[model samples]
Target: MRHRYGFTDEACAFFDFFAAPAPELADRTLTALQHALDTATLDHPRALRYGRLLQAYELMFWEGLREG
Candidate 1:
């Protein structure tokens, strides 16, 4: 089986926006879900979030699926 980090670079950046440097301590669940969905920068919010949910298994899932 394969595994990937629970958080992505963008997720870390999202956590940093609030924690400053404690992404590890950041809540990856719904607590940060909204912000993530908001900052996904994707043309399609639904699709971007869907990908983020699986980014670890496949970085391409949400790597550039979002818009700026």
Candidate 2:
């Protein structure tokens, strides 16, 4: 996907995570999501809501990869 500011090579490659040619891209995205979940906290107001959203994204990614 092109943008006015343009994407970094890594960012462009990330979009191809579902491609079979490089499954590692998907793995890396999953790992990053896992890390975000691990370090997430509820120390601030409305943090719970954001945390839930992040958790949901992680679950979706995990299931997507698993099903593929």
Candidate 3:
């Protein structure tokens, strides 16, 4: 079976921005994203949202690399 998921324009932009980097930079990107997530405070709603978005993109980037 196949599944479909919908993403907002903001989410699509996030994915596209990260997806442009070379495959070799995936690890670096993940590391940077992790650092940002770790440093982001829960009190700031926008920061938390972006941190989660970065995490999602990190997973997607890694999976894309594995498949390609």
lDDT winner among the candidates? 3
Q: Please, what is the TM-score per model?
A: 0.20, 0.35, 0.35
Range of the 10 consecutive residues with the lowest summed lDDT in candidate 2:
14-23
Candidate 1 wrongly placed segments (more than 4 Å): 1-43, 56-68
Candidate 1 lDDT by residue in tens digits, 17-47: 6434445645665556667568974456676
Tens-digit per-residue lDDT, 1-68, candidate 3:
01235666665675566657667688996786688679873345776788799989989877996797
Candidate with more favorable, higher lDDT: 1 or 2: 2
Error of 2 at 20 (Å): 24
Question: What lDDT tens digits, residue by residue, belong to model 2 across residues 10-63?
Answer: 876765664445647689967866776788832444656876898799779869
lDDT of each: 0.56, 0.68, 0.70
For candidate 3, the per-residue lDDT at 9 reads 68
What TM-score quantifies how close candidate 1 is to the native fold?
0.20
Each prediction's RMSD to truth? 13.2, 11.6, 11.7
Q: Which window of ten consecutive residues has the lowest lDDT sum in model 1?
A: 59-68
Misplaced by over 4 Å in model 2 are 1-45
Which candidate has the top score in TM-score? 3
